[model samples]
Target: MPVVLLRLQEATGSGEGGFTPFSINTGLIFWTIVVFLVLLGLLWRFGWPAILKSVEDRERRIQQQLEEAERARVEAQRLLEEHRRMAATAKAEAQELIAKAKAVAEKERAALLAKAREEYDELLKRARKDIQEEREKAILALRREAVDLSIAAASKLLEAQLDTETNRRLVTEYLATLEQQR
Candidate 1:
């Protein structure tokens, strides 16, 4: 152990002096080249393929997602257009409904006004007829009363002053005057 330790210390101390700059070193260079080749082959066989496949899968998935998003966007645009069309139709229909309502109301109003005017004219004509009939009946009643009063007055006058012969002559003469006047 002690000898080994002394040799390790001496070798460490003399390393700089024992070293050469370039020795051609065919064996070391060959081993280094073999290790680098093995590592490169391993990377190509496993690591590089896996990495590239993962990259491709990611690109494919992203493309699919972008396509889906585009489809969704188009669908949204279509829905927006449909909603606009429906709104336009509804607005037009509402306007037409309102116009129709106003027209119907005007028509009803005109019909009611015409009916009222007709009824008013009919009532006025009937009332005028009733007034004329009532006036004729009143005149006929007055005439009848005047005739009764004149008959009563003549009976009293003839009874007080005229004889039977004079009464008959007066009645005959009054009847003759009535016939001639008529």
Candidate 2:
């Protein structure tokens, strides 16, 4: 043990001179490079594939989310356009309905006015016909009265000593004159 300790102390040169800790040792450097190469190879074979796969999956997920958002935006825009078109169609239909209603109302008013005019004309015709009939009845009554008065006057004249043939001839002439004047 004492001999091994003396050899290790001589190898580090720590007995007679103070050695600089920053100085490179060739054998230690060679062993460190060999250990580093073995560790790098182990990590490349066992750990790198899983890390790379996880990163790629995360990227794909993000891209899919972006595509879904874009599709949603397009669908919203289409719905808005459809709503506007429907609103415009409804407005046009309402206007058409209003116009049709107005037309029907106008037609009904015209029909009512025409019916009133026809009734008024019929009433006027009836009034004129009634007036004409009354006038004819009055004329017939006046003719009957005139005939009765003439006959009475002739009877009185005959009682006062007029000839019957002359009285009858005068009454006939007077009746003819009255008819002509009428």
Candidate 3:
């Protein structure tokens, strides 16, 4: 049989006029239109808004996540700057310490040099005083020897015996005559 004959048969209710096209099918057409309208309204009113709202909420969450990530990045940059400042401060402190140490060392060196100079000056002064004292002692010893030699010569020149009292008188008279000649 033809395919149209089978469709017309299914379209009609249980009856003997299934092969005819003029048979009543008003109720089938009406129910098909009513069910199609009901399905279209359900999709428009219920399904579409729920799907769209889900997409909008997902977009909002994604935006919030992006903002949080940006905040984290800015915070990390601030921490990095803080670390750099601390490192620079430490370096400056180290340099200052080194300068202070150098100054202290210089002071110590100057003090030691001054002490050495003072000790050398003291020793030199002592040496000069000792040399002067020795010179005076040497001159006194030479004078004593010259006096003894002069007395022996005078005794030899007398050529005659002399008493103690006469010797003393002669020495006194000679000394007085030498003074008058000068």
Candidate 4:
């Protein structure tokens, strides 16, 4: 390495223009152009195609990922819409069930009220019948009592033992006539 460096320094120093960066050498220029062309050809044959293929693969992968993301977004939106529709349907069904339940309750309440009214009417009719029967019994007892008293008073007033059957018939007929007049 040191020997090569010394030789290069001697060659550059012996040159008429020395090692000016801008000084052009035809041999150096020709060799540099030849080397540049060889390297360019090698890159075109091997390195450039490999680099291009890798870039294309990367771009394809990015495009596929973007497409997949778009598909997933669309699927998510569809699922969200389906969920919203299901929720609305469930809400409507619940409201329908509530209305049906209310209607059933109202019907039950009305039936119960009707039954209660029927029972009340039956009780009132029974009470009226019982009252009428008791009143009839009381009036029969009073009529019997009045008949017995009239017989006793007539017997006392006559001071004689009158035939009881005959007196009773007479008194009953008189009472019947009085009732008819009233």
Q: Of the pair 2 and 4, which is ahead by lDDT? A: 4
Instruction: Enumerate residue pairs that collide in model 3.
Output: none
Order of quality (TM-score) = 1, 2, 4, 3
TM-score of each: 0.58, 0.50, 0.42, 0.48
lDDT of 4 by residue, 36-98 (tens): 999999999998999999999999999999999999999999999999999999999999999
Worst 10 residues of 2 by lDDT: 15-24
- The residue-level lDDT of candidate 2 at 33 comes to 93
lDDT of 1 by residue, 1-182 (tens): 76766566655654564534432346779999999999999999988999999999999999999999999999999999999999999999999999999999999999999999999999999999999999999999999999999889988886787767877899899999999999
**Which residue pairs clash within candidate 4?**
none
TM-score preference between candidates 3 and 4, better one:
4
Which candidate model has the greater lDDT, 1 or 2?
1
Worst 10 residues of 3 by lDDT: 15-24
Candidate 1 lDDT score relative to the true structure = 0.88
lDDT for each of the candidates?
0.88, 0.84, 0.84, 0.88
Tens digits of lDDT, candidate 2, 73-115? 9999999999999999999999999999999999999999999
